[model samples]
Target: MTSTPTRSSDTTSSEYDSDDTNQSVHSDDTSSEDIEEVDEVVDNVAQGDPIWECQMCGALMWYQERKDNSRHSTVPKFQLCCGGGKVKLPLLEQPPQLLQDLLFGNQSPATKNFQTNIRTYNAMFSFTSPGMKMDTKINNGKGPPTLRMQGQTCHRVGSLLPLPGDSPKYAQLYIFDTDNEISNRMNSVRTNKDIDEEIVKKLKLMLDQNNVHAKVFRMAMDMLNDVNFQDVKVKLIADRKTDGRIYNKPTVSEVAALVLGDIDSASHRDIIMQGQSGNLQRIDEFHASYLSFQYPLIFPYGEDGYRPSILLRFVDDTDITKKKKLTIMHWLSFRLQRRKGEALTLLCSRKLLQQFSCDGYTMMEAERLNWLRRNQSKLRVGKYRQIAETPTTNNQSGPTLKGKRVVLPSTFVGSKRYMDQLYFDGMAISNDRPDIVARVFKIKFDELMKDLTKRHILGKVLAYMYTIEFQKRGLPHAHILVFLHPTSKYPTPADIDKIISAEIPDPKIHNELYNLVRSHMIHGVIP
Candidate 1:
């Protein structure tokens, strides 16, 4: 979250001291006047107009009214918000050197490009708003307003780049570390069972030597050993306040400056402050410009923006009251209408439609399963019971029931009724198969086998078999075996070379095939 610096009202010490001295000199003529002067000085020191602001929180205070007014110190500390540095936060370790060079190094094209379009870059990466709101209804419209911290206060990152032979960075580094991971897994089950300290010690020693998350492991160990660790609080959001009309809350730019290690740099401040114009860009503009810097994957193309080649299919040009414009929603609506049932209508509740559109079938399936589970005894007593009890004539023994049965009738999943209900099930009608990608792969495999056998692409397939399987990420793939006729078999190396090639297709001659191979056949490192 970026913080903006607030302009404080300047009060010169010379003017204040001179005015007070003159007042005191005249007041020395009378005891009452001297007492009044003393009271005035005390009041000025206690609750007079704020002149200095806290660095962490935006809490304002008079120079003399600071938490620590040491004579040796030029500036005083404010303690109300963050307990005068008692609440310390872990430092955000600097990014990799290569990344830093690309982003902030001198005479670099990446840096130049980034700086030239900093707004666009920031917009591409940032996730949440730094701006906070105050609850005016608190304290019955009295005292300081209660701070209402909303939105994401910190970056919620996904997986980090898997660099070869290096400790995992970011969230993975924290989670997979020996101490953190063991503590997390053990704590969940610790209530039910006691943890063996000896076993834990042995595991930690083993992990310390070979752990992939060693960096965070060392950091965690150090933090555990530190006596002052209890005082440290991770700096996530800026929660500061001021009383009355003295608005001292820091701006987004100031917060950003602090985070970027530019707290004292005038040139960086000038750039962030937009060249001393004192006029800050709107929140929307700030978000658009800086978000990209934080989450690059979300906006991979940077300033190029998302421009899909889709047109609006259902437009009402006749309605002159508003301009007709194409949008992503229009494209979605158009794609949805191609289904063979009733026309897509905008007259229904969009929220309900959205609910059913994405995971309605899954939800319905869950409900059906739950119903079957609840009525298992009732289902087992009827025709399902007969089907389960019916034994094979040559069977060594009748089928044995291992657990409670929850039979799904043919009518529920495979009959004409089941097919008919699909039209009204609110599922997205697309190329994808029902429920899972494995089904789609099965269909494609069937089509390929049909073509191979009928068209003889692989020469009179004598026998063929395939097993569909899913990857760790749930993507479906297949392993196939085909036996060709003896007459069509490639017996020589030359014959095999003629029929099969490993080289990529020439894009100029086989544009479509080249694209297909590039998009689907090719695989690369995950990162």
Candidate 2:
């Protein structure tokens, strides 16, 4: 979200501030699944013990026992993967300095044959050192390794095969091993295509500002086509320089022309899709609170990673505003807290919650919650961050309880330092009286900010965004998303619809609805 411009009688508004030079990235997808719980348990052996413990997954072994044990076991004696050989030469080789030149094949061998046949009988017997052989180890010698040799005691871990570094085979290996996950992600924008023109025009119109910024572009394609994806294509579609009448703007590709220099060499298969669309459909009865009205939408917001343009499958009446509040207490960890950017705030209706078994959605893949240990194993758990928020039963306000309110500092909200998913509303002072234009732009905007202290929702309002769609003929109605306190309560759908219809910025935030004008855009097959 960016700055809003003052309204005028001008037919079309000016372009938004599109200089997204700061490059604010939409959230990146993350997973803590493979993060093993490591505990360093020094063996009870004496201080001088020769065993070197595996620091990886916390498994221990005595040098002799490890050398003699069988190789096949579910619980490996060593934590890290080992190269198969009778002896791992790199792991040993005393007089560390001498080992460097020998391993590098830089030093002259003791004998001619030793130089050419490093692992042959000729090299072993033709030593040029004073009195040494490759097959012999001296226990008490002050001489170099060339003078005192040891038997070949190589390791026998796996096959002594080198891993893939740059070959296509390596890429395929990693892809198949990870279920082709790397190829599916749209992390860097270099691969994603440009945004459509209609979408760019619409976003500028929706927010009512000039010079909007298109920061990041998100694109994704699932390995499984049937799986649900959200907001697949995203870009910072902000306003470019204004040209008065038309508010001429540069396309995402135009301002980002510098990056295009490398596009020809990039493979289309490698890059994922990004940016937004003008029309998108809603998911069926899945979310009761999400789509009370059918209206056009470009992106579908969800809890997981973004995918390209697609129709919604189910009605996800999830209340992000309320969910964000609980996320802090449930998901983040101290390490994560330090890294996650800000405290996220969202508005949600508490009463919409069906079952508060105190459990939250499970994460089979990318997760945005605080990391925790549930059963000694590193399994994920969405704890009891649930708080049912209901507006005053009596509409009475004197520190009286009509609804539940939990106030947490921005630091602890959502565990990380990220603030997003705000919730706010602006209804006209009177539903019966109509002050169409001025009230919609100015008055509503003022009331929107003023509603902050009212505890309409539970989080702080850092950034805000809303939409104004042309409902029937020429006039516009709004579908906005705000960024505020995580604990904010959800505004009911009925209240939201009534407020939005008046077009005075009176629509209440709905945890479960979309503008009716957006219904056609809700159902498209995801690529």
How much lDDT does each candidate structure score? 0.38, 0.25
Choose the strongest candidate by TM-score: 1
What TM-score fits each model? Answer: 0.17, 0.13
Each prediction's number of clashing residue pairs: 23, 94
- Residue 36 of model 2 has an lDDT of 16
Off by over 4 Å in 1: 1-174, 177-357, 377-381, 390-404, 409-527
For residues 409-432, write the lDDT of model 1, one tens digit per residue.
444775454676774352343223
**TM-score of model 2 vs. true structure:** 0.13
Q: Residue 458's C-alpha lDDT in candidate 1?
A: 75
